[model samples]
Target: MSNIVALVVIRVALDRDDQQLRRWERKIAFGYRMFIGLYALAGASTLPVAWLIARASFVSYVQSHLLYPLVLLAVVEGCVEWGLSRLRRGRHTLLIVTGVLLASIAIYFNPRLHAIESILLLPILASVFFLSPKKVWLAGILAMLAECILYWLNPFHGHESGTTPYDLITFIVELVGETVVCHGIIARGAEIWEELRKRGRLETELLVRQIVSEKDAKTDALTGLYNRKSFNEYLEFALRISAETDTPLHLAVIDIDNFKQVNDRHGHLVGDDILRRTARAIEYHLAAGDFLARYGGEEFALIIPEMSHEEAVAHVEKIREKIANIHHAELTTQHATVSIGLCTYVPGEDSQALFQRADQCLYQAKKSGKNRTIAHP
Candidate 1:
């Protein structure tokens, strides 16, 4: 019971966000439910023991003290669990009330009859789990006060002191020492939990930063496509895979027609805008698994896996038609067009040789005319 109550109090006191509280309320309530069920079973089991005991004093003691207080404790536990489940008000109030009742009962019963005041540990320890440190102090103070009041009202109060006011210096010292130890334990545990959370947050942030850095390294800033470095690396990997598996892979190099004239007539910014738009248009025509990258200034490289030489030509020609039909009123009177050269992978060919053949086909396309695809035989 002390562990469960203390944990809840700590959580509630530390909670600063309403959304987090709402999220945790159901789970927190489960602890309280378990406490109530176990306590109720304990109360019920005592009845059989009370009935079987034939001693008059034992039966009387059990009936007057044990059974009644157990019943009250069970009721308090039930009320607390209900309030927690509903997430309603008076939850904390019930906890405080329960603490006071437990303290009073412990002092009254005084199982050992040696320093009944030490029973105050029940509420003091329980309240330490609450969110606020203030509650812990409060619980200790109230428990001590209740014990003192009961002591004063007792017929045996002065009997132990023998005509002198009871000197509680020893008890007070012990209480202070125990309370400090409890706080120290709580403080240490809280520090460890906070440090772990901080470390976890930092690790998550570093992982995210690393991912973004890798993406930027592989991407072209101007066209937002894979840059030349990434293009070469991807081609090398794709060529190796093709060679090993004897899979069909097609490569294409595309260049904008009259690109130098467009840059000469207009500023570089306008030319850059045209290039970005052209990249988007070409990218739109590609299917999934096809790779496109900015190979150099005003040039793009493409790779299509699982395609024949004829299929590769058809794909590049489609992108050429799309680029040719683009109407850019801001830059040129005629629409921008691209010349594409496509070729299929030869068995066991290296990346450099494959790319060189594709580049030769592109040169042939440029020599033949602009705005058309030329395929290597």
Candidate 2:
């Protein structure tokens, strides 16, 4: 019985583990979809503005290199959105990397378009939304560095044009504003994401623990089978189903014959071992629709759905033979045997009446001599 209870506990643990893994997978997929949609929308909104700026800018090199790359990034972002819609994990990362690379190359070639640093906001948000906090911070740092490098280069011939003090102050203020806003947003998003991840993990752990606790509560400590409480619950549910379907049900009460003698001869420990082994042997012969529960010390109850009295009796006989064949040498005992009492379900009968009839048969089995089965017609 202890072995059976252990098996039930293991099964519940495995099921809970599987459920948690699925929950995490779903959260990741949801986050990925949100990233793709937001990026695609941001890219679409920024593409026309990028083109207009490029047309108005004085640097021919900036218009050709920077504007073209921005448009290409918009296209890649759109493709990533479509890939996410199709449930593809691979295409999303690929497009994000490709877009970032193209944007970096454009900035490196045409430092004059440093005014377009506003575009960095998209990458900063995307990195934080989809990647870890560390990666998001790294992306933000890289954007800041790129802007500073472009500011120093002053590639639009602004340095040669002898930039005034007012222009320099305005440029510095814009740079600081852009960096502060983008960094703040990305950092805040990262904080929120981390909190959510922590909560989700905690919830999963709590749910698994609760399931295990409930399973343990329903299980018998000694025999590893369903205890009386759990058995009663199962019996009630089975009886209800049988009544609804108009199917026959069979109940059997089994007692270990001469169990007290075994305990007296071999000590209580050995006797316990014998009880566990006997329960296993009986379980091995049971059909899938049948269930057995430890009813108390040295006694077990079996419920077989859709089984008639004759069939149940025959099955009990087989179990008696199997028990007789079981070697009790490990327990330092001579022989181990079980006596069974069988009763078939009657329509509109309660559990008490059913149990009483089976118990009466058990008394008859013991009176006729132990180690045999008695059936109630």
Candidate 3:
């Protein structure tokens, strides 16, 4: 039951793919196996006390149980691991646990052995541990039947204490009551598990869809740069921060020279390749604090922060030169050029006015000569 909860939480948090979920599931399975091994060790530890109570030497107990719990541990661990690995059915595992616990009880079944009946709870617990209600009932029934048969036919205790019908009835009622309670608990836990699993899946699906929608809304499909809307939002943020911090900010609009002719002659595929390459070139020249966006077709925008006017100029110039030098294989020996218009932000200047100023500088660059950087004074 706890494993189910852990699985649901981990899947909700990290299950982006089937492979990732399987990794977590495997880890949980291994943890459950270790728990079973520990349970076996814990159960086997009570053996020496039972041995001493039987007036048997501890050495005899050790030898009888096979070298100090090692053999029992190996057997229990082997049975559990084999069931977990080879058998996917819950009833198969239930039977295995029932067998192991019943065998343990039978091993210590003697007139002198007190409270050996407690080991029968192991089957019920193991079933409850895995959160299987039907299996819990099966284990409880098997444990009661085994107890009745062993107590009825035991040669060591012929009509001894706890051998009467009333006592057997009481034991049966207790076992049945515990099993019913465990069954109910597991049934209720199963309901809660289902509810949480469904909720986690719905929430995860919604989160994933939201993430994809956000990406689509903010990023250009062609060049993977920020779209115009994202750029506008970022520009407002950059301007506000620059004013508040008294830091300088530069804005630039870059236009690819002869883009229409390239699209007309080389085709849209080659034009798209050129656009992607141009975006990469500009991005390669950018610092960590700089921002680049696909303003629109054949045009790009950039925002540079925390830089002096000279540094901004040198940065954009490097970009302008890099684009001019790209030799696209799709265009053979032909090349492309970009004209850049840059403007430093004035404190308290509105975004539209600042954008217009950069556009005006771009017009100047286009008019004077293509492939040149024009800065607004």
Ranking by TM-score: 1, 3, 2
Instruction: List all candidate RMSDs to the true structure.
Output: 8.1, 7.5, 7.2
Off by over 4 Å in 3: 1-119, 133-156, 162-188
The residue-level lDDT of candidate 1 at 205 comes to 56
Question: How many steric overlaps does candidate 1 have?
Answer: 6
lDDT, model 3, position 339:
93
Over 66-146, each residue of candidate 1 has an lDDT whose tens digit, in order, gives 667666656766666666667566554456556666556645553335565665665566655554456666666666576
Give lDDT tens digits, candidate 3, residues 1-377: 34554565567555444444345435544544564465457547877676768754766765645453445545655565566566555534534353545344444433345665666665676566556677778878887887687666655544555456776677778889988989999999889876876787777566666777899999999999999999999999999999999999999999999888888989999899999999999999899899999999999999999999999999999989989899887775578899999999999899998999999999999999889999974
Q: What is candidate 2's CA lDDT for residue 69? A: 49
On lDDT, the leading prediction is 3
Candidate 1, residue 217: how far the Cα is off, in Å: 2.1
Clashing residue pairs in candidate 2 (N, C-alpha, C atoms within 3 angstroms)? 1-223, 1-224, 2-223, 2-224, 5-224
lDDT of 2 by residue, 1-377 (tens): 44555555556656765566445444544544454455456545655766677656635534455456456545655555566457544533443354354445445554544354465454555554443445455555665555555556655535654334465556546545655665677678668756875575556566667777897898887788888888788888888999999998989999999888887877999988998899899989998788899999899999988877788789889988998899877555467888889998888998889989998999899999989999986
